[model samples]
Target: MSPLRLVIRLTAVAAVAVLVAACGGAQDPDVARVATGLLDAVDSGDGAGACALLAPPVRTELEDTSGSPCAEAVLEEDVGAPSDTTEVEVFDTMARAVVGSETLFLSRFDGRWLVVAAACDPVAGKPYDCAVGMP
Candidate 1:
C-alpha cells in the first residue's frame, strides 16, 4: 500500500480503538472503587455510612421491610465482607462487581455510583438472590 494510504488506515484503526476503550471495554476504576468502598463500610460495621452508599430505592426497601430506619436496617442484613474486588463489569450506567464470594450490582445516579444490590448469590437457571435490593 502507498505510504499515505497506510497512514490513513492506521489513523482509522487508532480512532476505533479509542472509541472502544471509551465504551467500557475494560474494568472501570471508579466502579470497582465504589463496590469496594461499600464492602469496606459494611465490614467496618458502619451502618449509616453503608446506607449512604446504597441507591435510594434499596435503602427505602430495607427500611420498609424491616420497619426501621435505613441506618439500622442496613446493619441487620447479612451482606458479606469481601476483602478484595475480583472483577467489575460496567454497561453504560449499570455495573456488576464481584468481590470475593459476593456479587453486587450498582447504578450511576446523580453523577455517582451507588450500590443497587449486595450479598447476591447466583441461583441455577434464575436471577441472582440478594439480601438487599430487588430479588
Candidate 2:
C-alpha cells in the first residue's frame, strides 16, 4: 500500500479503537461504584475503607507526605463529603467522577477501580488542583 494510504488506515484504526475503549469505559459500573464508595467512606469517617479505595501510588503519597499511615493521613486531608455523585466518565483505564462539588480521578487495576486523585477543583486553562494525587 502507498505510504499515504497506510497512514490513513492507521489513523482510522486508532480512532475506532479510542471510540470503542471510551464506550466500554462508559458502561463500566465499577468505576462509578469505586468513586462513590470512597466518598461514602470519607463521609462516614471510615479512614481505612477510604484509604483502601485509593490507588497504591496515591496512598503512598499521602502516607509519605503526612508521615503517617494512609488510613490516618487520608482522613486528615480536606477531602470533602460529597453526598451525591453527579457524573462519571471513564476512558479506558482512567476515569473522572464528579461527586457534588468535587472531582475525582480514578484508574482500574486488576479489575478493581481505585481513586488516584480526589478533592479536585478545575482551574481555567490549567490542570485540576487536587487535595490528593495528580490532577
Candidate 3:
C-alpha cells in the first residue's frame, strides 16, 4: 500500500484499539475532570478556552481543516458541545470519554490531559470516524 494509506490504516487501527480497550475498564478521575472542562468550555461557547485545551496536533488539524485558526474553527465546528461526561476510560496517557453518545479522546502533556480528538464514532467493523478532531 501507499505510504499515506499505510499511515491512515495504522492510525485507524490504533484508534479502534484504544476504544476497544476502554470498554469495561476503570475510568480515571483526573482525566475525567479535564474532559469535563473541555466539554464545559465548548458548551459555554468559550472558543478560545476550548482551543487552549486541545492537543497541539488537534489544534493544528483543526486550523488546517478549517483553513482558519483554532480559536475560530473550534466554535464553528459542526459537532455540538459535548455533555454527559460519564464512563470515562483512560489508558496510560490516552483517554476516551463518553459525552452524550460521542467519544472524546484525550492525551496528556505537561501533566495535563488535552483533548486529542472529539465527536468520534466507531463504525461497526470499521475504524472510528471523528468529526471535530484527529486520530
Candidate 4:
C-alpha cells in the first residue's frame, strides 16, 4: 500500500481503539454492575434504594433532610433513567461516572461502592442543592 494509504488506515484503527477505550471497552464487570444498579435505582425513583448506594457523607446529607420540601419534590419528580450510554471509570477505591452532562463520583465504603458527589450547574436547570440532595 502507498505510504499515505497506510497512514490513513493506521489513523482509522487508532481512532477506533481510542473510542473503545474511552467507552471502557473492557470495563471491570463488578464496577459496571454497581454503576448500572445505582443508575437504575435513581431512575426508578427509589430514593431509599439510591440512598443505600451512597457513601456515608452523602447518605447522611440525605437523611438530614427528613422533612424538607426538596426531598418531597425529588421523590415526586420521578427522574427518568439516565441515558443508555453512561460512562464509568473505576479506580481502587474511587469511581467516576458520566451520565449525560452530569458526573457522579463514588467511593468504596465498608464493603460497598457508594456515590459521594455529583456535579451539576445551577444555571442549567440543575441546582447544587438539588444535585447534592437528590443524588
Candidate 5:
C-alpha cells in the first residue's frame, strides 16, 4: 500500500526466493549422483575415479597447482568422507552438494555434471572458501 510497505514486501520476497534457491534437493538428481559418486571414490581411495568426476577447470587447477596428474593430486585433498549428502542445490548450470561436514560444487557441461570444487565452506555474504578448485 504505502511506499515503505511496498519496499519491505519486495525485500521479503527476494529473501524467500534466495532461501528457496539455496535449499533445494532431488529435482536435480544427476547433480546429486555425480556429487555422491565423487565422494564415494574419495572415500574408497580411488584417486583415478575421483579425478574422473572433476570438472575440466578443477582438473586443470589440480594439475597446475600440484605439478602432477589430477588422478594423483585429488587424493591429496583433505575433503571429508561421504557420510550423507543433503541440500543438493541446483542453480541453472551450477550445483552444490552438502556432504557431511563439507560441500562440493558442481558444474554442468554438455549435459554432464562435474565437480568444480570440494571441501568448501560458505562465508556469510561471500563466495565459498574451498580446499580444491579455488579460483
Candidate 6:
C-alpha cells in the first residue's frame, strides 16, 4: 500500500474512533427518568408516591419509621431541581444518581425503577432510605 494512502486510512480510523467515543458513551434515559420521578415525588410532598418508587428494603424502613420528623426534614430541604447535568452510574439492575448535593441509589424491580437509598449528607441526619417504605 502507498504510504500516503496508509496515512489517510489511519486518520479516518482515528476520527471514527473519536466520534464513537464521544457519542456512544451516554447514560441510559430510563435511569434519568427514574431519578426525575423520585425527585418530583419528593418535591411534591407525595410520600406515598415516593414510597411507591422506592426499592423494597428502603420502603420497609420508611414504613417502620411511622411518620417521623425525619420524613418532614427530607421534604423540607431545598435540594434544588433535577438537571440534565446529573451524573448516573448504572449496574445490572441498579443505578446511582448524583444530582447537586444529593445522591440517590436505585434499582430496577418488576419492570420499574425504584429508589433504594438517598442521602445528602454522609454523617448527619436521617438519610432517606427509600427501600424501607415498600409495602
Q: Which has the greatest TM-score?
A: 1
- Cα error, residue 113 of model 5, in Å, equals 0.7
Tell me model 6's lDDT, rounded to 2 decimals: 0.65
Indicate the TM-score of model 3. 0.72
* Residues 39-130 of candidate 6: C-alpha lDDT, one tens digit per residue: 77787886666556667766556545656543454454444465556788876676777776667777788877777776444555765543
lDDT (10s digit) by residue, model 5, range 1-135: 999999999999999988877665337888878888888898899999998899888888889999999888888887777866466877878888886777889888778999888977789999888889844
Q: Provide the lDDT at 19 for model 3.
A: 82
The lDDT of model 3 is 0.77
- For model 3, how does the per-residue alpha-carbon lDDT over 17-41 read when each residue is reduced to its tens digit? 9887765345567666767777788
lDDT at 129, model 6: 43
Off by over 4 Å in 1: 1-25
lDDT (10s digit) by residue, model 4, range 1-135: 999999999999999988876666336555445555656776776666665665666656655655443333335433335665667777567666666555666677786766676533436565343355333
lDDT of each model, Cα atoms only?
Answer: 0.85, 0.84, 0.77, 0.59, 0.83, 0.65
TM match of model 4 to true structure: 0.55
The weakest ten consecutive residues by lDDT in model 1 span 21-30
RMSD (Å) per prediction: 3.5, 4.1, 12.1, 8.2, 6.1, 7.3
| Candidate closer to the true structure by lDDT (higher is better), 2 or 5 | 2
* Residue-level lDDT for 110 in candidate 4: 82
Instruction: Quote the lDDT for 26 in model 6.
Output: 49
Per-residue lDDT, model 1, residue 65, is 91
Candidate 5 has a TM-score of 0.75
| Best first by TM-score, ranked | 1, 2, 5, 3, 6, 4
Evaluate residue 86 in candidate 2 and report its C-alpha lDDT on the 0 to 100 scale.
Answer: 62
Clashing pairs in 3: none
Superposed by TM-score, candidate 3 places the C-alpha of residue 20 at a distance from the truth, in angstroms, of 20
Error of 4 at 82 (Å): 1.7
Better of 2 and 4 by lDDT: 2
What tens digits encode model 1's per-residue C-alpha lDDT throughout 24-65? Answer: 534788778878888888778888899988999899899889
